[model samples]
Target: MLDHAVQSLREHGVRMTPQRQAILEYLVTEHSHPTADDIYKALSGRFPNMSVATVYNNLRVFKEIGLVQEMNYGDASSRFDFVTSRHYHIICDTCGKVVDFNYPVLDEIEAVASQLTGFKVDRHRLEVYGTCPTCQAEQTHTH
Candidate 1:
């Protein structure tokens, strides 16, 4: 499926440079939301010839093509997500881990916003912040 995605990206004039391909492949298999620095670290070993700027440039292309999503949760570092579907996120305040949450209520929330605000709504992102289960467990143990 990802190969098809990459081919589609190339067809749409994405350059398809080797570095860009590597980035896309990495994103498809990664479950964790990774920052640019994280990506640079992982690729540095194999792609010593590739520059961090190249990763940023390719990420921009992926975002432009809607193949990747960039997220900023009031953090200095921006994280990148590969899952592009309409979904919400739960960000762990302790670990800074991000997980996808598919809630049907989000549609209702969008409807309410449109009804009350009288604004044309195309899309929305809902980010919930809290300690993850593992973090909560650790806190309990410590206390």
Candidate 2:
């Protein structure tokens, strides 16, 4: 799995540094939609020289190479996902967890894009924000 991720990264003109490989591999394997800091913390113990900024830079590289997807939800931090297939994201406003989802009807939205925006839209991004099951329970109990 990680080998495929690293191979994709190298094909996209990104240097196959250990840090870059580690970050991309983690993103592909982990589904919690982790942020750069989350990754840095988990890795720093193993790699004392790894910097937080390095993690962010690697993520940016991954995004540029189309190896990773980024989601910003006004939470002051960008979330990252490694799945490259066209899909969407769900964010828990309470716990800040993100989940991946696919909508079969999303093609209709793309079909109307050219007519509505008057631009030759080739792709689009969709993200829905709400409470996850765990967060919903916490909210109900807190009330």
Candidate 3:
């Protein structure tokens, strides 16, 4: 996965610095949709000189080059997802965990909307939110 990410970055004309490599490595293996602060906290100890701003900048670059997706879940901070494929997310309201699930694209809805509005339709986003199993289990135990 790291090699694939490196190849993709090279193909997109992005410089492969050590910091960038570390960031890519983290993203490729992570599914939690971490915020920039989460990334910085995890990496700053290793890099020593790295800053939160650097993480944010690299994430912006990755997003612009289609290497990552920025997700806003009504939180104060936006999370980043490395998976670029067409997939939906299920967010845990209690624990704030983000999980990915694949479903067939709903092209029929787009077609119907376009027909109704007489405008071209683009893409769409879907996110389902609820308490995760762990949270539910915890609630049961507490009660």
Candidate 4:
């Protein structure tokens, strides 16, 4: 995955710096859908001079180059996902965790919408929100 990400970045003429490499490595390995601050906190120890702004900047570049996806969960910061394939995310409302799930594409829905509105349908995203099992268990214990 790291090699593929590096190749994709190079294909887009993006430089592969140490910081960027570290950021990409973290994103590819960590499926937590971490925010920019989370990334900075995780990598700052290794790259002592790296800043949060650097993480944000690299993330922006990655998004622009189609190397990563930026997800806004109505939180303070947007989270980053490394997987570029078409998939859906299930977010835990109580714990604020994001998990990925793959489902068959809903091409019929897009076709219907395009036919009804006469507008070209590009793509769509679906996010399911609920309490994760751990959160549910915690709630049960507390109650």
Candidate 5:
């Protein structure tokens, strides 16, 4: 996946610097859907000179090249997701943990929406929020 992403960037004429590669590698290796600040903190030990701005800029480039998607869940920071395919997110309300789940593309919803509204629907996002297992366990223990 990392190799394919690097190739895609190369085809787009984007130069692959070490910092950019590290950022991309982190995204590819970690499915945590991290924010720019999260990424900066995680990689700072290895990349002492890299700044948060560098991570943000590289993330922007990755998004532009269709290698990643930025998800804003009404949070203070946007989380970056490595593009795979059509999927939805299940978020833990208690801990703000985001997990990906797969379902068939809701083309029927788009069709119905377009028919009812007379507009072309490009895409849709679905998120389910609930307490995660760890959070549930913690709550149970507290109660």
Candidate 6:
């Protein structure tokens, strides 16, 4: 996956710097859907000279190249997800965890929407929210 991502970046004329590679590796390996600050903190030790702005810039480049998708769930910070496949997220209301879920695309809804509204339906997102198991356990213990 990392090799394929690097190839795509090179094809798009983006230089493959070590810092950029580290960021890409982090995104590919970690499914936590991290924010820019989270990424900076994770890589700060290895690349002490790398700045938060650098991480943001690299993420922007990746976004433009369609390597990642930025998710904003009414949160102050945007989390980045690697574009592996079409999937939905199940978010933990208590702990803010994002887990991916797969289901058939709702083509019928898009067709109906376009037919009724006279607008081109390009895509859609479905988010399921609930307390994660760990959080549920904690809540039960506390109560």
Candidate number of the best lDDT? 6
Question: Tens digit of lDDT per residue, candidate 6, span 1-143?
Answer: 89999999999999999999999999999999999999999999999999999999999999999999999999558999999988889999888899987876554778889999999998888889999999999999999
| TM-score for each candidate, following the candidate numbering | 0.90, 0.88, 0.90, 0.94, 0.94, 0.93
* Per-residue lDDT of candidate 2, residues 73-103 (tens digit): 8856888888667788888887788888988
Instruction: Itemize residue pairs with steric clashes in candidate 2.
Output: none
- Who wins the TM-score comparison? 5
Model 1: per-residue lDDT, tens digit, 26-75?
88888688998889999999899888898888888888878889999884
Question: Lowest-scoring 10 consecutive residues by lDDT in candidate 6?
Answer: 101-110
Cα TM-score of candidate 1: 0.90
- Please give the CA lDDT of all the candidate structures: 0.85, 0.82, 0.87, 0.91, 0.92, 0.93
Sort the candidates on lDDT, descending order. Answer: 6, 5, 4, 3, 1, 2
Error of 3 at 45 (Å): 1.9
Worst 10 residues of 2 by lDDT: 5-14
Put down candidate 3 lDDT per residue, 58-91, tens digits, no spaces. Answer: 9998898778899998945899999667888999
- What pairs collide in candidate 5? none
**Candidate 5 wrongly placed segments (more than 4 Å):** none
Cα displacement (Å) at residue 142, model 1:
2.5
Off by over 4 Å in 1: none
Model 1, position 42, has a per-residue lDDT of 93
Model 5 lDDT-worst window of ten: 102-111
Model 1, residue 43: distance off in Å is 1.2
